[model samples]
Target: MVTLTMDGRKIEAPEGATLLKAANSANIEIPQLCSNEELEHYGACRLCVVEITHKNRTRIVASCIYEVAEGLEVNTRSERVLNVRKLVIELLLARNPRHPSLLKIAEDLGVKKSRFEAEIKGCILCGQCIRTCREVVGVSAIGYEGRGINKRVATPFEESPPDCIACGSCHFVCPVDVIPMKEKDGVRNIWKTDFPLQKCESCGRYFAPVKQLEYFREQYNLPPEQFSKCTHCR
Candidate 1:
C-alpha cells in the first residue's frame, strides 16, 4: 500500500495503482475522457493532468498513467491543471463539436465554446475502440492510420478487415458513437464487413455471429455443439 495527499486529503491506494485510480477511490473528481476502468490506463487524454509535488519538486502528469507514490502531494484542481484539462476539452470539442459528452465536460470546465475550427469528424482519436478491439476482443481489426491531424482509426488499407469477428466490442467500448454498425436480416455489418449471425436451435433466434463463434472455438478449443445455442437458451 501507498499513501498520498490528493486535494489536501490523505488517501491510501494499493501498490502499483495509478493516481487516477487512487483519486477515484477517494471520490476525487479528476476529469478524464479517454480512460476506462476495464482497460489499461492510457494517458492519451491529458485531461487528468494534476500538479504533484514530491520531494519539493512539482510537475504535471496525466493522473491516469502516473503511478501513485508515497508522500506525493497532489493537487487535482490547481489552476494549471484546470487550464490543461480545459484546453484538452476544447481540442476534443473541435474534433467532435456537438458530442454531448464533450459539451458536458466543457460546461463543467467553464468552457462555453471552442475557439478552434470545428472538424466534426465525431472521433476524438481517444483510441478507445482500437484498444478495446486489441486488448479485450483480441482482434486488431481496426487501428490508427496516418499521422498528426491526418491520423484516424481505420481498417488495413481502408478495406474490410478479414480478421474482424463482428462482435461489436469496439462499438460497445467507443465513448462516442462513431463506429457505425447495424444488424439486419441476420447479418451484422461493421468496419465495412458483413458477418452472418448464427441461429440458436432452441430459441430460433439470431444471436451470436458465426465468425465470432468460430473464433471462440479456435481460441478455446470448444466443441462445435457448444455454439449451437445462445447463452440465454443454453
Candidate 2:
C-alpha cells in the first residue's frame, strides 16, 4: 500500500494504482468520460485531469492513467483544472452540439453558449463501441475508417459487413447512441433469421445456431462421418 495526499486529504492506495481508480475507491468525486471498467484507459476525454505536485513541481495529468506515487500531492478540483476542463467541454460541445450527453456535460460545466460555431458530428470517436464489439463479442465487423477529422465508424463498403454476427454489442456500449439499430413497429429487433433447426438424428438434441445437420455439414465443410456428432441428427 502507498499513501498519497489528494486535495489535503491523505489516502492509502496500491502502489501501481492510477489516481482515478484510487479516488473512486476513496469516494472522491472526479468527472470523466471515455472511461469504463470493461475497457482500457483511453484518457481521450481529458475530463479527469488533475494537478499533481511531486517535489514542488506541479503539472496537469489525466487521473485515469497517472500512477499514484508515494508522497505525491494531487489536486482534483483546482481553479486552473476547472478552467481547462471547461474549455475542453466547450470544444467538445462545439463539435457535437446536438449530442445529449455532450450537452449535459457542458451544462454541468456551466457553459451558457458557445462562441464558436458547432462542427456537429454524430460520433465522438470514444472507441467504446469498437472495443466492446471486438473484445467482448469477438466480431471485428465495424471499425473506424478515414483519417484525422474525417474518421468515422463504418462497416465495410458502408453496408453491413458479412462478418457481422448481428450481436448488437456495439449498440449496447455506445455512450452517445450514434449507431442506429434497425427498428420495426417502434421496437428494435435483434438479428433473428429463420433457419431450420432439425433434431440431430444421432443425438436427438436441438442446436439452433447450427441449424439443420445437412446445412451445418455444407457450411462447415464437415465430413459425412461428422453427421452422427450433430446434436439434431445424433
Candidate 3:
C-alpha cells in the first residue's frame, strides 16, 4: 500500500496503482478522456494532469499513468493543472465539438472555445479503440496511419479488415462515439464490412456476430454446442 496526500487528503492506494485509480477509489473527481478500467494505462488525452511534490520538487504529470508514491503530495486542481486541462480540452473541442462527452469535459474546465480551427474528425485519437482491438479483442485489425496533422486510425490500406471478427469491442470502447457498429436483418456492419449474426438456439433470436462467437469458441476450446445459445439464453 502507498499513502499519498492528494489535495491535502491522505489517501491509500494499492502499490503501483495510478493516481487516477487512487483518486477514483477515494471519490476525488478528476476529469479524464482516454481512460478505461479494462484497458491498459495510456496517457494520450493529457486531461488528467496533476501537480505533484516529492523530495521538495514539484512537477505536473498525467494522473492516469503516474503511479502513486508514499508521502507524495498531489494537487489535482492546482492553477497549473487547471490551465493544462483547459488547453487539452480546448484542443479536443476543436477536434470534436459536437461530442457530448468532450463538451462536458470542456464545460467542467470552463473552456468556452478553441483557438485552433474546428475539424470534425469525430475522433480525438485517444487510442482506446486501437488498444481495445489489439489488447482486448486480440486482433490488430485497426491502427493509426500517417503522422502529425495527418494522423488517423484506419484499416490496412483503408480496406475492409480481413482479420476483424466483428466483436464490437472497439465500438463500445471508443470514448468519442465515432466508430459506428450497426446491426439489422441479422447482419452486423462495422468498418465497412458486414458479418452475419448468430441465432440463439434456445430463443431463436439473433444475438451477436457469428465470427465473434466462433473466435471465442476457437480461443477458449469450448464444445461445439456450448455457444449455440446466447449469453442470456445460456
**Candidate with maximal TM-score:** 1
Superior candidate under lDDT, 2 versus 3 = 3
Please write out the lDDT profile of model 1 over residues 1-234, one tens digit for every residue: 998899999999998999988998899988887898878888897888999997788899999999988989999998988998888998889888887877888999999989888887888888999998889888888899999889999999999898899999888888778998999999999987889999999898999899999999989999888899988998
Task: Report the C-alpha lDDT of model 2 over 1-234, residue by residue, as the tens digit.
Answer: 999999899999998889999999989988776778888777877888899998888899999989999889999989988888888877777777777777787787787777668887767777887777677666677788898879887777776465565556777777777776664432333333223333455666533323234544676799966755454334
Best-fitting candidate, measured by lDDT? 3
Tell me the RMSD of model 2 versus the true structure: 6.5
Model 3, residue pairs in steric clash: none
Ranking by TM-score: 1, 3, 2
Off by over 4 Å in 2: 185-234
For candidate 3, write residues 52-137 as lDDT tens digits.
Answer: 99889889999999999999999999999999999999888888988888888888888888877998788999999999998888
lDDT of every predicted structure (CA atoms) = 0.89, 0.74, 0.92
Extract clashing residue pairs from model 2.
199-232, 200-232, 200-233, 200-234, 201-232, 201-233, 201-234, 202-233, 202-234, 203-234
- Model 3, which residues run further than 4 Å from truth? 232-234
lDDT of 1: 0.89
